[model samples]
Target: MTQHSDVVVIGGGQSGLAAGYHLRRLGIEHVILDAQAAPGGAWQHTWDSLQLFSPAAYSSLPGRFMPAQEGEVYPDAAHVVSYLADYEKRYELPVQRGAWVSAVHRDGPYLRVETSSGDWRARAVVSATGTWTRPFLPAVPGRRDFTGRQLHTVQYRSPAEFTGQRVIVVGGGNSGAQIAADLTGTAELTWVTQRLPRYLADDIDGRALFDAATARRRALDVGRTDTGGVASLGDIVAVPPVRAARDAGLLCAKPMFTRLTATGVEWADGARAEADVVIWCTGFRPALAPFAALRLRGARGHIATDGTRAVDEPRLHLLGYGDWTGPASATLIGIGRPARDAARQIRDLLG
Candidate 1:
């Protein structure tokens, strides 16, 4: 026997919570299934001392504001998790934690969602599983042969654990740069990155970027019907991380490695860099394995969805997808519009 709902949200993060809240406001009954034991998916696993580059005002969900201490730069990961938990409790959202969705398939007219616990049937499904569930690490040649400890930024909690060690941090994104800076005084650090360097402006924060990105996303969403192939680099630029890294002289504006030896990494230019610990600051990708049937576009394994609708499957939708050259399409602010639009579409379909 399987439980049923008008809709089933396949994540318990902020996007999913917003979906549930909207659906409830519309009087549409729905259940949210999450893999984690609680809300706040990646935030719970992030490194300590991590704060949102964006401010509390822009980071808040639909109805509630993210509480913050006066003069705080941004809310930390723990604050984010606490805010999410409070949001869940306040709404009493129908979320079943620890129910890791293994597969989702279209069974007749409804979608069948199989989890570790059991199966569920829903008329509509919203994949709010943001693009950070899986860490994207390159397959370095001699990665397996390295005897010392190596871990992704996801597993890194703090620099306290790596005191006095030679650490090589790879990737040029915010995480990579910030982590490199964090380990600077505590440990010897080297920063590495691939080609096509993306730099942030000297003057933006989460609030400003969020507002700018939101406007751009809205314009694009309205102007274009088929946004499948269009790629937008949202407002990923903010001053905090970039400034911090620049001040610390930790930015590695170079291409990636060609090979990895047992002792060190070989760059494309034939230069070799060695370190005791290799921290792949490579970013994350969406965990879309459960929706295997829905073929995604791009070799990078990202789903191709129109602003709100999945390109391959009309009935399915993707929220928090990174849009090309716009405001923060993949951030928390970027997800709300898509989620709301998708939920509305689902409600109409159910009717």
Candidate 2:
């Protein structure tokens, strides 16, 4: 039997849960479908040592706030997972875990969402699958010829596993910096990037970044084109650990290498460096494979959207697709406004 819902949220991560929080307030009938076996979404898969760039007071979902743990200024990934699970329980949002969404296609007047467990027809759909699953690695000549282990950040668990081995961490983003810092005690680490990494001042964190972005976005929303673009939140935030690393001179990085040789990477100058492992912190693309049947993604592999609303499919909304959906929508604190707006639109449509 095909189940039907007023709205079906196709992810149980930060964005989907935030949307569910709004839909509940609107008294909409909806269910969140999570592909993960548990409630944490992508947080469950992050590296064990991962910590939020912001303090707990600054990073939270809607309806309730993430409480700061004793002695922990910044919550680690496990803490976040625990909080997400607790939030779901506290709100009683109807979520179907282990429901891997396979595809979503137009079905007459509704969107038919096919999943591993079954199918659902929904009046409105919010796609928030996020980017963790689609890790990206830059192309390099002789990449395949390298016999050394190469993995994206998503596959990394702990630095202990690579203790004392030569490791190359690639990318200038926060993830690369943080992971490289984590490896300092365990690995013979080398940081490689296309360019020099940018570090936000020690006083700034994810909270300030999100706030600045919100202001800039709201200015643009009001038809003022003078909103100076906010700095990228990807810049390394000087959290305690990252700060210590920088002060200790362990956070240094090198420019990108030219290619991957059998033993390791070679620089543009033809200098070869030996490495046992390469951790590519290159980043991720949104995981919206379930919407492939709609063929809405453009040449850039991203869907055109009027804010969070799909431009080609009015009944479909794309959240957590990053800034294209909403300013800082990919972050915990930045997703709430867009979620509320999306839920309101769904309510108006259904009514």
The TM-scores of all predictions, comma-separated, are 0.88, 0.97
What TM-score does candidate 1 get on C-alpha atoms?
0.88
Query: Which regions of candidate 2 are displaced past 4 Å?
Result: 222-234
Q: Which pairs of residues collide in candidate 2? A: none
lDDT (tens digit, per residue) of candidate 1 on 219-293: 666895443221233223544655676666665555677777787777767898777898998878877888996
- Clash-forming residue pairs, model 1: 54-206, 194-256, 213-327, 231-324, 232-323, 232-324, 232-325, 233-324, 233-325
> In candidate 2, what are the lDDT values of residues 144-228, reduced to their tens digit?
9999999999999999999999999998888898899899978999999888878888888888888878878888889887455
**What 10-residue stretch in candidate 2 is worst by lDDT?**
226-235
* Predicted structure with the largest TM-score when compared to the true one: 2
What are the lDDT figures for the candidates, one per model? Answer: 0.75, 0.89
